[model samples]
Target: MEELEAELAQLSGKLELARESLKRLRITRETVTEVLAEMEPEMPVVAVDAGPPRSGERVVSAYAGAERRVIGVLTVPNWQPGMMPDVLPSAYRDIVEVVADAPGPIRAKQIVPRIGLPAETGKIEGTRAKLKRLVERGWLDEEAPGLWACSPSSTACSGSCCG
Candidate 1:
């Protein structure tokens, strides 16, 4: 009877220790999760700009099978309703002029050259703006941000794909 009582006492003590250990483990796990969560810092995100005021949404655009950052997105301004002319023809003529005159894809203010008209292609408004208009009218293609190229569409560059 004495030996049985001693064994029961030992088993009770072990059960109590196990319960305490389980409680401590739960508390430790909670503490670790909270600490890890607090370790991460929040990042700031700004909205999109219209003009040159650091505007525009942070849209992740895909280029050539890889993701790219959209540095800027400019909308077209002088688009007539009926005239709906081909955007690239006029712009292409101007780009050809500038390339024949002085060849360089240098930035002319906000307008990225080669993507549209050259900075010196015309003395009108912005070359980039013309490119945007052309893109809207299916004339040119903006392969990526700050990287515009003559579109490889059926109507635009017909020979390349069709032929």
Candidate 2:
């Protein structure tokens, strides 16, 4: 009976130590999360890059919709609204511009007329092909069959999924 009692006492002490270690682990996790949150940068900062903000250098602006970081400067033609086309073929660029302006996901058929392309069968098929390619290139997202929208990485568009 005394041996059994001694063993029980040792087991209880080990369990109590385990509980204290678990508590410390949880507290450490919470502290790491809080520190990460505090280190995050504010949204929508415009920083000038002319050796040190000269009087006339253009003040370029950028935004991070999520945890992604801006590693370097990216210059593209017509980056404002209704723009954001990279160095792509004119046909591909036109599709990007159209989708950027859309209030919601747009179908390939809808994009055809707006882009001044003919509504003929061949043109419609071509537009669908372009949209698929844009999805591959990460400039657009095809939310569903034939439906498309600009990707989050595209200028002026945000959100993880379809705009």
**RMSD vs true structure, all candidates:** 20.2, 15.7
lDDT of 1 by residue, 18-37 (tens): 99998897676556434433
Residues 1-163, candidate 2: write the lDDT tens digits.
9999999999999999999998897676556445444442422232223353334222233443333222233322323444335455567767887887799899888999989988888889989987887787577888887889877666535532223
**Cα lDDT listed for each candidate:** 0.43, 0.63
**How close is every model to the real structure, measured as TM-score?**
0.27, 0.44
TM-score, predicted candidate 2 vs. hidden true structure? 0.44
Q: After superposing candidate 1 on the true structure, give the runs of residues whose Cα lies further than 4 Å from its correct spot.
A: 1-92, 96-125, 159-163
- Which consecutive 10 residues in model 2 have the weakest lDDT in total? 68-77
lDDT of 1: 0.43
